[model samples]
Target: MKHITILVPDGQTSLSSVACIVGSYEMFTRANGYWSQTEAGKKNGTKELYKIELAGVSKKAEFDNGLLTVTTHVHISNISKTNLIIIPSLVRDYETAVKGNKLLIEWIEQQYKAGAEIASMCTGTFMLASAGLLDGKNCSTHWSAADTFRTLFPNVNLLADQLITDEHGIYTNGGAYSFLNLLLYLVEKYYDRQTAIFCSKIFQIEMDRQSQSAFTIFTGQKSHGDEMVKEAQAYIENNLQEKISVEQLSSIFSVGRRNFDRRFIKATGNTPVEYSQRVKIESAKKAFETSRKTINEVMYEVGYNDVKAFREVFRKITGMSPLEYRNRYNKEAVV
Candidate 1:
């Protein structure tokens, strides 16, 4: 049987993090039972596919101010080898979580060097990134945490709009609850499409959700300590219905155009034009979600008069057409 170790980090973690541990254990256990009844199981006499274990630096980890405690089956030092390791989401204060879990981080690196695949769920990506495993790799974390993650891990490519990122045997997913989607993807990879679909149906998880873009709420990054950039961000947000230009912003902010562009990108991780587009699209998304406005109505409200331009940009940022987004999010919208 393939060995699967779920790393239980020490800290005040999100409830979802603990859920990932319990959920993963249940998933593989059920997968093993289901596989045993298949024709292939009878042919090869294969029963259990994966032996799952929860491991921590210590025997147990407490969370939520000691309201909850997770007991681990094995210590990190004891598990010298494993096929896969699942890292749960970190606490809100990620820097402290990283600092506190140094042992877990080191163990993760050792395991990866020994040829074990690593998968981090939600903010668990922080642990892998802290271990220097994601320096040049693409990663995904919760959309709300994207700004903070980028500030901390500038070398790693953070695809906040992605639901899952898989490269070099390191897998990551966005959002706290989206780990279910990642679990399903793993099932499809290690088992088969049939088994993955079966698990999805059993868990009531929507299958083939490739992007978390539709769920992201773009709150412009303003903590970079650039007063001019903060003013520019406020301007872009306030003027969503107007056509804002980089040159115009530069002139208004009394900075050179090129210098302004550099400062804006450094502060917000987006060019002035891209920032404007995101702000406009975010406003348009809100209108679609809460109001019975037509696509064109919302587009024009967000300063986009051209139908093709609006549709393309909306789809690019949100991974969905305007009507589709409305139908999915707006309960009153007719499908």
Candidate 2:
């Protein structure tokens, strides 16, 4: 139900609209970069440059950043009715402090005070954090700028390990392409799963509903040393109903217990026992939502040897007991 506004700097990337439609979207351009014009140098090549028009929106141009600025005034005047503000990645001179643009920061702060959700994609997070919007909130940026972002905003809880971090109303995504994932989450949250799925299929992208950490490490290419670890993970997923132990995994991999433990930990950042527990917990969560089974039945389905132990592990990992999680997340999944 929220109306979204996307703030475009000079060199605005193309993916901003993807997030805009997830709610309602308006585009705001700043006084730098190209503004829908073709360059003369590319006229001779087979490629051609074209101008893009904004729908249902008007354009204003100005000058700032020591260059010829052409864009609308970034003030409370333009954003008074917006419910969310999105900052897409911008092309800037990284060596200099283009992030310190005063008017832009003021507009962002005004929007925040007006109770609009603040979001950023890729390097756009730099602009938000530089405006002090991300202080004390968990956020992420493109991995390439992880170190630099930390250096600039040490007060911000920079989550370099995950592709996205959503704490309260603030959302930040890492990597350039993770913008799609963030947008999908917004669609699912504000609209519905079916709408999110429709948009995903339209874009020919995988429907990624899990948190950013789920896909961060399992990208297209798997690490060679981690192959066996992945195999172990697959084995656990396939056999969530069966009890698995480190001793069994060691034999299956044809390695000693200590060697298997070390390899699994090195590859997954979790020990074999810990990883297996996570897999079982996740499986149990799914079963809890979809089946009419009771807590004991769900426990057995996920290979928990005892109901008490299952309750403890499930609570530890999910911050809720099985029944509680089901009540919160299960809603129409079960018939």
Candidate 3:
């Protein structure tokens, strides 16, 4: 049987972490049980496909200052091996979360080195990334935590736009609550597409949501400790309707053009140009949400005169055309 281990982390974890573990366990165990009860499942031997359990640093995981405790099936130091390790979204104070679970982190590394696949949910990617498992690998985390994640793990190809990423034996999902997508993906991979669909209906998770871009709210990084880059972000936000230029920003901030671009990227995980585009697109998003203006009008309001350029940029950032975005989100849109 394929063993699935859900790593229960300590610190101020979200209830979704428990929810994630239960959901995964339920789906896998239910699938096996359901199929076993059926003649086809019995004949095919699909019922004994997976075994699920929770593993942690200790037998009892205390959270919220001992208010809640999750008893584990196995302790990390005791378990020799498992087929898969699922890292649930730990607490948001990622640094403390990592520090508190040093042994669990080490155990995860050992498991990965022992030929087990590692999957991280939301902020759990922080732990995997902390263990250097995600270095040079494409991964994702919750869009809200994108800035912090990028700042901490620069080597990780943090694809914040994707809902899920699978590289080598590691899997990552974009957000904690949206983890159902990744779960379904895993279910489909281990079982079958048909089983995944059936499970989705049972769990009420939407299938085939490939991008987190549409739901993402673009908030520029301002906590990178660069005052000049902060000023540049403020300028871009303030002057979206104006023709904002890199040279202008660099000169305004008393930095050289190439050097300014580099600094801005380092400070915000986005080049000056990319940052400006994000600012403009975010402004356009607000317009679509609050105004009855046409797409072209909204584009122009955001200082883009060329229709094609505006549409392309809008689609790139939002994962939908201007019209589609407006139709979906704008309450004022006409029939």
Candidate 4:
């Protein structure tokens, strides 16, 4: 079993705990969202004020240079059995500690020297760069911080194009949502294709390989103002396996069919029908890669009742027949 320890500074992005780690994951949060066990606790109301757990790990809370410090002594008084150390995100002032925090810097150096995989998500790359672990190593961070990171760590090979970069056991990802891609990438690497696909489906995300650049997220135009349109889009994503028509979406949103069509097109740059087809096609691609289902079976699974229409849509969107794409990915998987 692989163990992962996530180090969170005073201010860090709060993500779903389930999304962060798979098994036996430990988090060190400084100041963040309140934790709850049941979904009702998170939804309606609860009395939890976000308590921190100090058991199973030694907790060290101190003030250093005007910053609240919370460090966890992981695997202390033992064999130091940590396979992976993750730095999620850090405070904005973390960059100022590049020269300071010699103890933290040395700890990072020692971890890397002892062969623990070091990884960061978002601006956490600053910590790695500050510790000089990324010197001459290829890494990536949130595209927003590329300029500052480049200026600060000139010696580090920075790649802003990709979602994640893995070099010499050091992995870094673009900020926020890019963590999904990073986790999927890691899942594909350490596990099998089926496991990666399963995890992606569970998360309601399309499975994407790391070679695909992270810039895709920025390129998509957002349409969040209209509540009806947003609800329709969410419905489409959740029901990718079911047949969806513009009329059905309009009815669900309690709008006229003509008005819904116009609004959907205006908001998403694609008509409701077109967008739903794209979603189904993307789902089909995942099914093809992850399961032993035949191309026809995948077609039906993605809501294409007619085989001919499914093939045409798949080719139109993917630039290849379903079988062709499947064969290509299969060959690559074998290699």
Candidate 5:
């Protein structure tokens, strides 16, 4: 049986951390039980395929202002070898998390070097990246953390739109409940497709969810201390109904086009044009969510006249066409 060690890190963690730790342990345990009942499992003469345990740096970890606590089954030092390591989500500031959980991070690195696959849930990618395991690997995390993750770990490829990322035996998933999909993925890999499907049915989790883009709210990056770029971002947001151009913005700001583009990208992590489209799309999304606006109406309101062009850009940014996005979000929309 493969041994799975779910790490309960010391220090502050989110409620999702609690869910991930408990949910992963239960899922794997149930998966083992379900597999045992199968005809194939009978032929193997085994009752379980995995030995699951919760390990932590401390005996207990608290959450939600100490209202809840998880008592780990074992300590990290006690486990010399593990087949897989599961790191749960942590509170937002990863630098603080890394500093506080130095021992756990070191242990994670050691385990990986010793041939264990690692899976980080949600913001747990922060810890994994802090350990340098994701330095050159592709990973996914909460979309809201994309800018911060990019700034901190530039070497790591952050696929913010993806629901799950699996490379070099290191797995990660996007925010919140999306971790369920990752569990399904690992079930299919470690067990079989049939078993994974069975679990998905029981858990009521949608299978093969590939993108989290539709759920992302694009808030422009404004922390980069560039006054000119900040003004440009403000202008784009305020004037979403107008067709604005990068050259126009540059001329208005009195900066050369090339230099303006560079500053905009450096400050906002997007070129002027990309930022403009994102801003407009974000406005269109709000209109779709709260208003009973037609797709064409919303498109025109966002400064796009051509229906085809508007649909393409909306789908590119949100992974859903304008009508589909409206129907998904607006309860009044006719599906």
Candidate 6:
């Protein structure tokens, strides 16, 4: 049987806040029972697909002046190992979560070295990233936390628009409650697609939600201490309807071509050209959401007259064609 250890971090706890632990427990337990009764398991003799347990560094995780407590089954030292380690979303301050779960992080690294797959849900990606597992891998965190996550872990590829990321047996899901989609993906990968579909219907959760881009509110990456990049970002946002080129931007910013590109990328995690496209697409997204503009009008308004080029960039950034985006998100279109 596959050993699945859900590590409950030593952080604040309340019935209202412990969604990760409870949600994962319910999914796996219910999934195991589903497998047992389905024809999909007829090929295998054993019915139980996973041996799930909640392990933690502390005996009892209490918070709010001991008003709440989360009981753990096994201590970090008790378990020799397991097949999978799932890090749930940390509800408390991320730094606090990391500091309190230092032992759990070490254990997770040990388990990975011992051939176990690690999956982090939402902000739980922070813990896995802390372990240096995501240093050179593609990972996703909640969009709201993307800026902070990128600031802290620059080496990790923070795909803020992706709902799930799976690289080298290390998996991570986008921020917030999107962990349900990640769980469904895991169920399909570990068990079967039919089972995953069954669980989706049972839980009333949308299946195959591959991108969080539509929900992401782009406020521009300006937290870095680079004033020039901030100015460049502002210029791009202001001139979305104007034709702006890298050469002109660098010259206007009074920086050398090579240095401007490097500084902009390092500061904002996007190259000058990529940043411009994102700014334009963001403007276009707003137009799609609130305006009844035709695709052509929106395209031309965003300074893109080439049908193919605009469609391609729109799809690349938002993961949906312009028309599809308008149809789904436009309140005016719905009316």
User: Who wins the TM-score comparison?
Assistant: 5
The lDDT per prediction is 0.89, 0.60, 0.85, 0.62, 0.90, 0.85
lDDT per residue as tens, model 5, 111-185: 999999999999999999999999889999999998898888889989998999999989999999888999999
Worst 10 residues of 4 by lDDT: 23-32
Model 6 worst lDDT run, 10 consecutive residues: 11-20
Per-residue lDDT tens digits for candidate 4, residues 1-335, read 34455553333323321233321132212111222333533563644423322211235433334244444544332325456666655544555544434454556677788887877777778889888899888998876566567667779877765678988998898765667777667655644455556566666556774533313222222433677787888898888678877778888888999999998876665688877876787777777667667877787777777888898887766657888778766655334
Q: Which segments of model 6 are wrong by more than 4 Å?
A: 12-17, 40-43, 62-69
Summarize candidate 2's per-residue lDDT along 202-231 as a digit string, tens digits.
555577643343223222112435677778
Candidate 3 Cα errors over 4 Å, as ranges: 34-46, 62-69
TM-score of 3: 0.92
The lDDT of model 5 is: 0.90
| Candidate 1 residue runs with Cα over 4 Å from true position | none
| Candidate 5 residue runs with Cα over 4 Å from true position | none
Per-residue CA lDDT of model 1 for 238-301, tens digit only, reads: 8878988788999999999999999999999999998999999999999988999899899989
lDDT (0-100) at residue 172 of candidate 4? 91
* Candidate achieving higher lDDT, 3 or 5: 5
Error of 4 at 158 (Å): 0.9
Return the top candidate by lDDT. Answer: 5
TM of each candidate vs. truth: 0.96, 0.47, 0.92, 0.47, 0.96, 0.91
RMSD of 2: 15.0
Superior by TM-score: candidate 2 or candidate 3: 3
Residue pair clashes in candidate 6: 142-175
Pairs of residues clashing in candidate 2: 60-71, 61-70, 61-71, 62-69, 62-70, 62-71, 63-69
The count of residue-pair clashes in candidate 6 stands at 1
C-alpha RMSD (angstroms) for model 4? 17.4
